[model samples]
Each structure stands twice: as C-alpha cells, then as structure tokens.
Target: MTPMIPMIPTSTTIPLLDAMLADPARAQAPLGDGPARARTGVAVASFIDGLRCFDAGPTAMIARVEALAPEAQLFAWEGVGLAAEARGQIDVALAAAPTFAPLLLVGAGWADALRGRKIGAPRCAHVDRWSVLDGQGFCLGLLDRRAALLEFAPEPTVALAIDQGIGRSLYFVHGGTASAIERAIMDVPASRRGALWSGVGLASVITNGLNDTARADLRERGGADLQLGEHLAALLLARISTPPHEPPTGWAATVLDGSEPPIAVLRRGLDRG
Candidate 1:
C-alpha cells in the first residue's frame, strides 16, 4: 500500500523556492518541454519554485504567475487556482484567474460542504468550459498560447473520485496516441477506470495550456490536427457514462489540504495514487 504523504507547508517551501530562483545559473536554466504525462508535474513544480518570498498569499500567487512567460503563466495560474480552491479559498482561486471560476462551478458537489450549504452543481458541457481559447480554430502556422492550450488539453476520463490525480495522469498520454490510451484504460478493472479517467480530466484542465511541442506540432500539422484533437477529447468524454459529479472518495478534500503546500500534495497524489 502507498503510505499517505502529509502535505508540506509553504512556510517550508517558500524559502527553498527563493533560494533556487535567486541563483543566476539555476534561474537562467532552460525549462524543457517534457512529455504530456510529466507536463503537469513540471509546471506545478515550476510555479512553486517561481514564487518569491515577497509574493505572499493567494493574490500574490496569481500575480507571480502573470510575470512568467505566456505558456508558463497559464499553467501556473491553473495550478495556483486549483490548489487554492482545494484549500477552501474559492475567492482567492477565482481571483487567481477568472477562467478558474468554471472549475468550481462544474459538478463540484464538494463545494457545498465547503460553503456550508447545499448548492446545485451546474451543468458543465466541457471540462475546459472556461478556457479562453474555446471555439477558436488553431492553425498549424499560428500556434500561439491559444493554440497550445487547445492542442494540449487532455481527453476526458471517468471520475473515480473528485480530485486531480486522474486528470494529472491523463496528461501523460500524447494527444496523437489518445486512442491507444483509451484502449489501455479500458483494460483496467471496470471498477477502477472511472477514478483513473476522472483524475486525468482534472489534471487536463489544470495543465491545459502548458505544452510547447504540442504548439509546434499544431504549427506543423495544421488545422486538421486541432479538429482531430477536439473530436477525440469529445469522444473520450462521451465514453464516460458517469456524470461529472464529485467522486465519493475523499480525493478533493485531500487535494484541498488548506494547511499544506499544493505542490507537495499533488506530487504525492500523482505518485501514490
């Protein structure tokens, strides 16, 4: 069994992050664009590292992300927002990025518990409902931030629990190999597949706009690739008969660990789950 890892406090992280980013060599080091599966991990870690000591509180987190390069900024913002939301600071999360508002509005049944009231989950058509690049066709030659986001968005999976693990895992699959991924997922025991897919979908939204190669690929493949990706994502979501309700497992609560650092919690969740 995977031992439960406690969340690391930011008080412990902020100083370490400060030291790393302050180093001229380390700060200037190239940030490589890794594979889709590892993309979220890289972005979440980078967000935590990029944050400075002076940038305290949730609002500062958002501001810090804004200073990063466009690709990094989008992923960092999503990471900050989702992590903050898990910690019960919905207001802070939304302020981090207005686009994040939809994440909370989605079938987040857990929100009621956080808000201390029973609120109905809104009908969310696409997990990326709040993405700024929706409905826009991304041409291969014109792969910008918007194109990258659309290109790299993960295909939806079933929800075994209401958390980010499944979503994070989905990021591992290259967009072109989505059909093979679906087949492999179907091979998992029927009982566990929902949780697996749900985690992937959750991570998809958080790390939506982080890929650089996907952008280059779009520039190379042209609009057909973009449309194909959207179609595949839709098809995958359709396979998930489960409604977008929060998973009964206490995944989000663990994710929403208010007292601990979101990066540490997510890293452990990805590794152990």
Candidate 2:
C-alpha cells in the first residue's frame, strides 16, 4: 500500500507549486485570472451564500465548494475571505490557497478592510480586486460598524468598489430593507452614495434577498443606482449562469441593458426609472 503526499512549494517540477513560493495574492497569477471580471462577479454573487459556512473548518468548507462546478468554486474562496478577515488575519487565506483553488488573490477592499487600501493586490485582478473589496466591505458592515462608516476609499473606482461592498453589507447588516438601507447610507459621504446604492441593488437581486414590493422600495431608494445593482447582478448572473437560471429564467434578460464592463458594473441601470 502507498500514500501520496501533498506537494510543497519547493516542488521544482510544477509551476503552480513554484508559484506557492511567491506572495499569496499572486500565487495563482501564473494561472492568469481566467476571465477575471467574470470570476470576481461570480465570487460576489455567491460570496454571501458561502458565508453560511463561516463556522465550519476549512477542510469541511472546501469539500462543499469542491463539489460545485469549477466556475462555482469561488463560493469557498470568498468565504475564506470573510472568515479570515473577521479574525483580523486577512492575508492568511491567500498565503496558502489549496491546490484546487488555483489563482488566489486579494485587493483594495480586502486588506485594511474597513480602510479600503489597495494592499496585496496583483495586477492580474485589476477589476477582480474590486469584488474582494466588496467582500471585505461586507465584513466591515457585519463586523465593524464604526470602521465601516469612518473609512472610505478615495479614488473614484476604488471608492465605487468600497461603497458598493458597504451597500451590499447594509442589506445583510441593517434589516435588508430599503428604508433601513437609506437611513444607514446617510452615514456614508454623499459622494459615495451612488455606488452604495448600487450595492444594495446588487444584494437584492444577486441573492434574491428582497421580495417584489420590497424591491420596489429599494428601487425608490436606490434610483439609478438600484437599477444598476440589478443590472450588475444580471450581468454577473450571465457569467455564472447556473441551472434553474438563477433569479428566474428571464430575470437576467429583463435587467441587462448592455455592455458588461471590465470591472463589475458598479454602474448599471437596467432601463428602470
């Protein structure tokens, strides 16, 4: 009888193995991002879904994620982001991505999560970096309210990512209502409001978190940003495209206006008023 051993980073014969010797954020850079925006978008859509496993051990969580189709595996990775961040050891997840979760990376929204710094990000995930930031934003909202409101991303796009993440967080943290979200958003600076609104739009549609009437409430509160949130969810839905057609078969077609972006569309309106 024989047993196989896990390959260490020192393995000279394998590139991915060699990659492990590099920094965690880029350990999978050798694999390229594999259509990064799509990857990040799917990660955001399912990130919350994976959070259910926050208390599970990594091996148990990885098993569940492994059973999913390849494109769907981000469910586990994004969960790793949340669990690691909550413990204040954010980079630990990427430091040793399991072999299956190839191409691990982090970005602006991840390190200094509440602060939204562009730390530890590799160029491979320029746009993908935004989604992790969104994930981190969720962490901030759920875990640290003071930091969530006090810190803000300065760059327009970076601000958009951080704000959107926060917006998504509000849906989970505050009672998942439009009115509550509106009141909570008041805490965000006015300049960041659009992206934050877009994020609520994202959370509602992506997770099917809100009902029709409540969604309408969000629409009024979210406005163009709400429509953008739905559109971004639709756009990423196309990227993930799981069976049962997530959010109903025609839902994506109804919301998608046009032009999926290089980054997750922090701005999309789905032709609604």
Candidate 3:
C-alpha cells in the first residue's frame, strides 16, 4: 500500500475561484441563456478564483517548499490569464535572485521560449495541458502534468521529490528562494492576468455544472469557436449529472483513501486554532 500523503497548508491569498463557485446566486446569474448561463457563471467564477489563489500562493509555495523538503509532491495548474503574466512572474523571480534556481514545467509548445532564457530555467519539463499567446508575441504553455523542482546557482541542483499521476498534474518552479519568488510574483500583470484567470476558472465551473442536452447543444453550436464560458457551463451541468469515468490507477486508489472523513476529521481537529 502507498503511504498516506499529507495535505499541504493552503496559501492565504485571494479566494477568487472558491467564492465564485460557492455562490449559487452567481452560479444562477444570466450570461446568455438566462438562468442556465447564470448557474454556469457561478461555477466558472469559483474555479477561476481557486486557480488564482493556487497560482499566487500554493503553486508558488510548492516550488519553494519542495526545494527545501525534496519529498513533497504538487498537483496544480493555471486555468486563466495571459501567458505574459505567467512568464513574467517567472522571469522576475529569476532575475531578482541569482542564488536560487527555478525549475519550470511547460507544455511542448512553450519549450523553445522558456528554454535557457536566463530568468529561471534550471530545468523545464513538458506536460500536455493548455497554452496561451503572450504579449511578447510568443506562444506559452499554461499548464502541465509533470515538473521538477530544482535549485538555482552554478551547478543547478534538484531539491525535491518528483512524482506524476495519470490524471493528476503538477506545475510551477522550484529550487528558488522566497525573496526571488516574491519579486517574480510582483512582475505578474495584475489586472489583465487576474481577469483572464478568473474567466478561465469560471469556465471550468460552468463546464462541470451543465446538463447533458444543454452541454450537447452547446458543443454542437460552438465547436472550437464556442465561447469558453458558455461551453464550460453547459458541460459542467451535464457532467454533474453524469461524471466521467475514472481511469484505473494506483494513484486513484490513494486519493480516494486520502479523502476519507477519518483523515479529514483528524486534519480538522488539528486545525482547531
């Protein structure tokens, strides 16, 4: 049996994704198809908010902590925002601190632009996820399923545990100091990235909240040109009624056990502060 993995402390950043999804009012707001659209919006909003918080806090911390711990595992992604903000954060972080090394997991398309760019390129792994066009006139990978956490400096040391799961994905850069990470975050385009990020999360919620017919109709109507938000909302409603089949894997078994109330109960008790 696989040993139980501890849940990392959540980062204390914005709860954009959670807020949007949790609110039925927002979920029920009319975006296009009236009530249905509103409901979809709510879910999308929650997802986006969650993504933002993850990126700014948990995602960033995972890298730093993994560098120090070397046994930690991270599962996360970027659901919204422009490629520029994502890349900019990494670049600034690397530039501000030379002592720390940063490792990045990028999509196959972004390998070229992010390779050997000086900012934070300790190591770059490719994962199949999503991509975006940056303001710099470059296509950047937005999500990945695999990554490495490495240290900065001449020798470029890897300082963390690297693991991957079939459906579970990991993202972010590691092996960098906290200060460098902070500087890099500062460089992210706040307004534009924030909006885009929120939109993406909202889209996810919407997708997960749709009914079968609505989802099918939306898909048939839009195809690739479909509005992300609308498409997601319908899809979500459909999925809620009928969840997708889970792939059989050891990791899936582990996650199921880890999510049991017994473990969650113990965790809550420990957090009674």
lDDT of 2 by residue, 1-273 (tens): 212212222332324322333333332221112112243345444443343333344455556556665655544455445444444433444433433121122222443453443422322243345555565565465556556666644466456665667776666655455677788788767887877888777766655644567667778877876777776766665554444244423434433222232123333323321
Writing each residue's lDDT as its tens digit, candidate 3 over 1-273 gives 322222222421224223333453542232334214434344334323323332334335334333431111111112222111233343332232212211122221133333323322322221211211111111121222112112221111211101111001101121112222223323433322222222232232323434566445534432332233333223323322223444334422222121321112222333452
lDDT of each: 0.35, 0.50, 0.26
* Candidate maximizing lDDT: 2
How far out, in Å, is residue 143 in model 1?
32
Alpha-carbon shift of residue 197 in model 2 (angstroms): 0.4
Error of 2 at 251 (Å): 20
Candidate 1, 170-228: lDDT as tens digits: 33433323343345445544544443343334444345653556544532432332332
RMSD of each: 16.2, 11.9, 19.4
- Each model's backbone clash number: 15, 3, 39
Ranking by lDDT: 2, 1, 3
Worst 10 residues of 2 by lDDT: 27-36
Model 2 clash pairs are 28-103, 109-133, 228-268
